[model samples]
Target: MSSPEHKQLIWNLIKDIKVGMLVTKELNDEDGLRARPMSLVQDAYDGTLYFFTSKTDAKAFEIAQDKDVCLTFSNPKDNVYVSLTGKAKLSEKRDLIDQYWNKWVAAWFKNGKDDPDVAILEVKISKGEHWDSTNNKLVQLFEVTKSNIFESSTPNLGESKKFGTE
Candidate 1:
């Protein structure tokens, strides 16, 4: 499919998930990587994703040093999983802050949206890949079992595709 079509499909799969794990390089950590749950702020999918973050947070610093980041979104019930890699930067744009402002986000800041620490983390996605299964759990299990019994082929788990700025 086309880039726009693939993006829309990804949005449809992940829009309800809301939260995704944002992974960034942590210079001080032993593993050299850190993953944190972040709430995605957007009504629809575009090429970019936004999240509210504290300007003083470690993630903000990490992104400053290395803009590359990865975001993972999953819905076990629907059997959809997506991974997106992108460049991230912090924005103090008041218009965006006001646009995505909500009570839930306000809880993170002491002075609500007016707080200096409140900042927007923008991730301009470069590439994204997703695995989606249309079958329910039972059917999926059956397929796996059938494949195992036959031992001639692998189970058809779902549709997997890589899309975006490739």
Candidate 2:
């Protein structure tokens, strides 16, 4: 698929998945990485993603120290998984913060959209990889079984593609 088409496919795969794992590298800890569950802002994906976060949150601090980050989304029932790498930064842009605000996000802040702690974590996605299994359970199981018995080949699960920045 074309780049635009691939991006749309990714959006379709993840649009319903409300939560994704946000992975960040801890400051001064080269070998340590932290991952936390975060909800997408659900506006639109135009090579970027947004999440609501507290400016004082550890993630915000980590992003300030190192912009590189990874995000992961999955749906076991559908057998779809995505991993995205990007650069992230914190923002207090009220207009943007208000645009993506909803009751669920507001619950995290005591003063609604006016809270000082409310911040927007913007991730400029550079590239991503995804695995999508399109076969039915029976077919998938058959493939797995066949592969196991054959002992030399792997199962033909589904489409696996890499998208974004070459």
RMSD of each: 1.7, 1.7
lDDT of 2: 0.89
Query: Model 2 shows how many backbone clashes?
Result: 0
lDDT string for model 2 (1-166, tens) is: 2366677787898989979999999977988999999999865677788899999889998999899999999999999999999999998998898799999998899899999999999988888899999898999999999999999889999989887676
Per-prediction TM-score to the true structure, in the order listed: 0.94, 0.94
lDDT of 1 at 94: 95
User: What tens-digit string does per-residue lDDT give for candidate 1 at 1-166?
Assistant: 2378777887888789999999999967746999999998889877889999999999999998899999999999889999999999999999999999998898899799999899999998889899999999888999999999999989998999887676
Clashing pairs in 1: none
Estimate every model's Cα lDDT from 0 to 1.
0.91, 0.89
Q: Cα deviation in Å at residue 144, candidate 2?
A: 1.3
